[model samples]
Target: MTDARRASGKNHYLWGDHCDGWRLIDGPDLSLREERIPPGCAETPHVHHVARQIFYVLAGELTIQLPGRTVVAAAGEAVEIAPGQPHLVRNVGNQDLRLLLVSSPDTAGDRHAAEPPGLP
Candidate 1:
């Protein structure tokens, strides 16, 4: 959302909130990030600036909120999030939630970061 350049280390976050966790990857026109959801975690409604995001479940279960609907994505399954749509994610399983969240055009992760490094 800003013109400032951002960087991260290994296991870095492209961006996320309480209900979600993610790591940034390298690319152009497309930005890749590995996302995860911990057990008992969730988030409120949110948005992405431009990129269309897709969440592919690698492990555990994820409850995704869209419009007035909520869908469950199981392991090996995936869900797509369109640009400008308000959405959220929650972990509904007993185990840790794991997923690969790939966002194209690199604009899906423009949310402002609320936490600084080394925070709990």
Candidate 2:
């Protein structure tokens, strides 16, 4: 039988100025995580070398910025990012933002920061 993992039973990591991430499934080919970002926190824009990723909003709202566009994803909505696309996710609400991040072929050591035009 395969083991089941829950957020309460998984390992947690802190990142991005008070954000928390729980690794629900960590594998070489794929990874699934539940992440929480407090209001006003934003991830720096970056690109993945090979992994494509999807962000599913569980609670609150997420402002996802791409190279030429920005999208707002609310609860139950998801956004897909192609590999090599420069993007970032930010919590622009007053409450905590909970989301699920799914990465294919893994994202470990595959990220590179990039400067988006007109963004500091």
By TM-score, who's the top model here? 2
User: Model 1: per-residue lDDT, tens digit, 30-115?
Assistant: 76666656787776466776768898988899888776577889999999988776677788789878788887767644643222
Q: Which stretches of candidate 2 lie over 4 Å from their true place?
A: 1-10, 117-120
Cα lDDT of all candidates, in order?
0.67, 0.87
lDDT for model 1, please: 0.67
lDDT score at residue 44, model 2, on the 0-100 scale: 85
Candidate 2 Cα lDDT to native: 0.87
Output the lDDT of residue 101, model 2.
Answer: 97
lDDT score, residue 117, model 1?
17
Cα lDDT tens digits, model 2, 38-90, are: 99999887899799999999999999888777889999999999998888889
What TM-score, computed on C-alpha atoms, does each candidate reach? 0.70, 0.88
Model 2: pairs clashing at backbone N, Cα or C within 3 Å? none
